[model samples]
Target: MLRTAARRMQVRGYADAPKGDEMALTFAAGNKVFYDKKVVKQIDVPSFSGSFGILPKHVPTLAVLRPGVVTVVENDGKQTKIFVSSGTITVNDDSSVQVLAEEAHPLESLDRSAAQEALSKAQSELNSAANEKAKAEALIAVEVAEEVVKAATA
Candidate 1:
């Protein structure tokens, strides 16, 4: 009787479970939490490997982000663009995405002129760097500053 009852019960696999139309997104920079468990339709991320879009039921992934713009598309079709210096993005099987960035700012908050000045300073430092460590740091600064300038102007 126990075996018969067990056989009569139906078991559903993870893939067979109902999924939501939206995904939860959390974006953080340093100690600040920009978006915490916000439901969104889609996310576009810039990774060192390549840029890709994340949607509901997307396969689990972990990507190392580059210095570029991250676009979040809401269910209502509204879009928000944020600039990130560098970070990691994790997509979970439960349709949740978390972005941890070293530095992040809204596109409108960025100053194009200031970003340009920083870029110039980074380049100058790269040229004047006397040690390998300094040169490496300056190179990274240049890359981040260049992205900031582009994002600010865009």
Candidate 2:
């Protein structure tokens, strides 16, 4: 959580933020996404499909997320990135985006080689997996690990 929170933090659009309490974002890695004073639209890409966005008066919704870089284009045309593991998000059309993830980190803050190694390790496990359950779990690990690598390398 942040101590001195800004009025807004935008990615692809304006970020309608909470008042006062500085949001403390965390993940298995680090926090890189930012909320500036002016932002409007935001897209959170889950693992399965891709990128999804939210705007003012969009609607109330819950979405499952996948591993990918959450691309945020600020109002000034500056794009930002955040790496998310398997997670879920709750959004209200009123301009509130609540992201709850099993893992959330800033790609910019991660160690590139470490993440790459994690991806490699997960891939090895995935390749060696036998049976449905093991394969499924390994697949998830591999996916998250790959996402971490993407975030770190981005």
Error of 1 at 118 (Å): 0.2
Off by over 4 Å in 2: 1-41, 72-79
lDDT of 2 by residue, 27-114 (tens): 2223333443334344545646556775444556677778777665554556667676767766654445566566566667778899
TM for candidate 2 is: 0.64
Return the lDDT, model 1, position 74: 89
The weakest ten consecutive residues by lDDT in model 2 span 21-30
Q: Each model's TM-score, in the order given?
A: 0.87, 0.64
lDDT of 1 by residue, 50-133 (tens): 999999888788999999999999889999999999999999888899999999999999999999999999999999999999
Q: Model 1 scores what on Cα lDDT?
A: 0.92
Indicate the residue-level lDDT of 103 in model 1.
92
Quality of model 2 by C-alpha lDDT: 0.61
Local distance difference test, per candidate?
Answer: 0.92, 0.61
